[model samples]
Target: MIKKTIAFKLTSGFVVIVLIAMLTIGLFFIQMFRQYTFNSKEQVLLERARSISELISENQQSSGQMQRYGGLMKALGTLAEAKVWLTDDKGNPAVISGMGMGRGMGLGNTFSSEPLPAEAQKVITNVLSGQESISRNFSSVYNEATLTVGVPIRESDQKVIGAVLLHAPVTGITETLDKATNMLAISLLAALMLATGLGIFYSLLFTRPLKAMNRTAIEMTRGNYATRTGIKSEDELGQLGSSLDQLASKLGFTIDQLFQEKGKISDIIASISEGIVAFDLELVPLSVNGALSEIMNQPQLYSNEALKKDFEDLGIYGLLEGIIKDKKSLQIFKDWKGKKLKFTLSPIIDNQNEVTGSVALVQDISESERLEQLRRDFVANVSHEFRTPLTVIKGSLEALMDGTIDQAQDVERYHQRMLSETKSLERLVGDLLELSRLQSGKISIHKEEIHLPSLLSDVIKSLQTLADKKEIEIVYQGLSDAPALIADYDRLRQLFVIFLDNAVKYSPSSTVITVEATLIKGNTFEVKIQDQGYGIPGEELPYVWDRFYKSDKSRQSKGTGLGLAIAKHLVQLHKGQVSLTSELGKGTAVMVHLPWILGN
Candidate 1:
């Protein structure tokens, strides 16, 4: 795992190249010096052989002269640092130099009876034929590497008579070459060391800019786009650094612009009431807005996996997949957890008109759907309410017109019945108009300070006759201590009258209806009416405020079902709230809270 940097590799390669060059030069110099020394030695030995051959040839006719020539040969051998030998035409030894020359001269066994070596014999044969010869490898005669040269002992007419051979060992030349080679090796080593140092220095200098650029690139990758390699030069590396800096600058600017656009888009998406989600081609969510999270009821759907899981749970993942696959838009209405949701999925396309991803618009249409249902029910209920009253009036008129009830008492009863049905129709119409006015904000409140106890007394007295028929006792409590509220006097009376009438109508015989008014939290005027009656079913409590919503089918004839609905609207017009609680076989309680307009 030891990573080698560019500098290390460059320095190593430089040193290796310098080493190879120095070694090659050193070897070549050594070979040339060896050849030169050998050539010089051979030339000097040839001159000595020629001179000895002339003297021996001159003294060949007289014994005394030949002996005199032996001494001369010995002296010549000592001076030339070589062994001298004279041989007859038949190749037999005649004169030889001996130990009188010096110690370690390699002059052993001069004039030995043993025949000469083959290579020496060849040299002597060439010399006797009036030709000179030289042999470097004469180890058979000298028992060492020696240079041997032979020359002819010829008469003045150039007739060969004998041969002269000179032998010189090459050990001295090799010793000299060894010393030269040692000095060359030392010089080459010094050169190599100097070259290596220079190579390393230049390598580091060349790679320094590269290293700086590398560090700058690393910093840029880590989001520091401002980092730069400040290498100013007219080289390739400098141009590369300049290019890198320009790339970083452009990339940083482009990224900033993209982020700004993304922020604006995100804000727009979040502000929308409908939920929105974006998915890549893989059907993995890329962006999920806050509205989508809220619609999914999962606030922590931040990760793609979590968002995808929510989509799958809501049964819309398959729709997104189909949109991506078909590159088409799709709309679906789904019921989730008792909520109506509308999902609109469309494929997102690129400039080439190829689908890249999909975007989903989710609308939680539960409230709107419920309102549409309420509209349908309202129309049906209005038709039914009017039909019932009009049918009774029609039947009564038809009976009188046909003389079906000729008795005066029967006719009077029919007249009263028709009047009662007409009155019921008028009440329904008036309640509907009042509800419409309250909801549309067309009705204005003429506000005035009204005492709570006095108002409850008047409401109770108004409904006392109806309560008496059922034997239901109406009681009022806590109103004596309640604070006065700022409200329209007639609206306040109508509000309480609705609650008390319902209580009296629903209560069983001998049952008690309790009406209580209190100031709650010092700012809310609360009125609660409870009755011992057949309570509404728990599941039907939520829709009690809707216009014409009847909780008890059997009690439909007791009063117009618009009472609670109109009462709720009146409470809202006064900036108050209304709620109901009931239990089967027990009783029902209606609670109304009006903001206590203090200091009014």
Candidate 2:
């Protein structure tokens, strides 16, 4: 498959036209030259015959004059390169001279005894009848191809007496024509060569601009739009080159603008928290944004096969197909690896209102849905908590007012119970407000450097009585050399009290509760409170930080379940981390890691 360029085609066509024209002209010239030579030979032969005829007619009466004239005819024939023949009125030969005549003959050898052949007789008969005759092939008279011209010998009164014929070999005229033909052929060949050279030159010159344009077009296809054909002329090729340059310029600008717009779109897509994916009409994944990659748990989402497989696994591939097929928009929900995902699929439409592809906007709504559920649960829990205390207070007041408790000891006991419940209600309200403030970033911490050992001693002493009531030992370890921490003094104390109180409440009377503080990594102050208590189940450990989440159903009435939840928020406010590890019937360990130096 050899590609033929425009220049080659043009050059070839021009060469062919030149060759055809040369052949036509050469053929015409050869034919005309041949005819001209034939005519010229005929005219020269006829004039010599007429002149010999007149000379013979004038010398007819004198024998010596006739002999002298015969010798003169021989000389004239030799000079004209022809054989001279004289014939009588009856078409008999009188004299023959020139070619084939013996050189040593006397002057009186003027007549030939051989009679003329029928073909020569016919020419002589026509000439003696007062008409001229010419023949190119009088072969019987000359034994070769010859040109014979005959003219009647006329007396002074214009009477025909005899005929004079000049026999010239046809070879002479042929040789002359051959020379002319050879010269013409040479000239034609030379012209053809020159024409071919000029054709090639002009063809290349004409196609040069086209070649440049082709090169520029190739560069553009390869994403290089800056190349140009620097051709300037007034011809059509120049106009075409100018057009090509204009198109390249416009295309380059358009591509640059498209790239800029695409970059902006990519940035917007990346900035979005929701996952985004695009698909072609065949439901093959075309593009996958970072958010979609994170949502699908596939970091290398650029691979179309991998992303398509993931879509199929998530049951989204079929949905995308349906959107493209039906040209309809759809919204669906999916739960993938505990993530609640909402996918909005819409068809991409062109100006003709036809669906070209489809795009899927995947929103990870797990957090939002979880928060909504938490809100509902929080309202229900708050109502139940308030009702219980209110019911107890209402019941005791009714009893005291209606005189149901007449004994002084029972009356004072009911009074004490109501007061305790009121304090419990107050504490619950205060904890709720404190947790809310921490979550909403409304509570400000008054940070200061406080000695770790002293802080632990105070927290332990505050809870010592409660631990002693259960005969539980509260031991503080690694606090002697623990570094000071920058945190709110009151909040830190509250955090520790919540841990120790829960520890003592859940532990058996003989068990020991250990509170250990250590400087970890030379930067963090880590506190671990390990208690030999009825530990939380592994399944419930994750939700321990959720508000109002109680692990022990039986112990739900003993204390508010907001302790760990509030501890988590306080730790987070200090830019620290809190975690708990526990096993059923074994024990629970609450670990809090606080940076020694909290940032502003």
By TM-score, the best candidate is 2
Q: Candidate 2: deviation at residue 265, Å? A: 5.4
Off by over 4 Å in 1: 1-257, 271-273, 290-315, 401-408, 479-483, 598-600
State model 2's lDDT. Answer: 0.81
In the range 247-273, model 2's lDDT, one tens digit per residue, is: 999999999999999999999988887
Clashes of each: 0, 0
Can you tell me which runs of candidate 2 are displaced by over 4 Å?
1-205, 232-243, 256-277, 287-318, 335-341, 360-367, 396-415, 481-483, 597-600
- TM, every model: 0.58, 0.62
TM-score of 2: 0.62
The Cα local distance difference test for each model comes to 0.80, 0.81
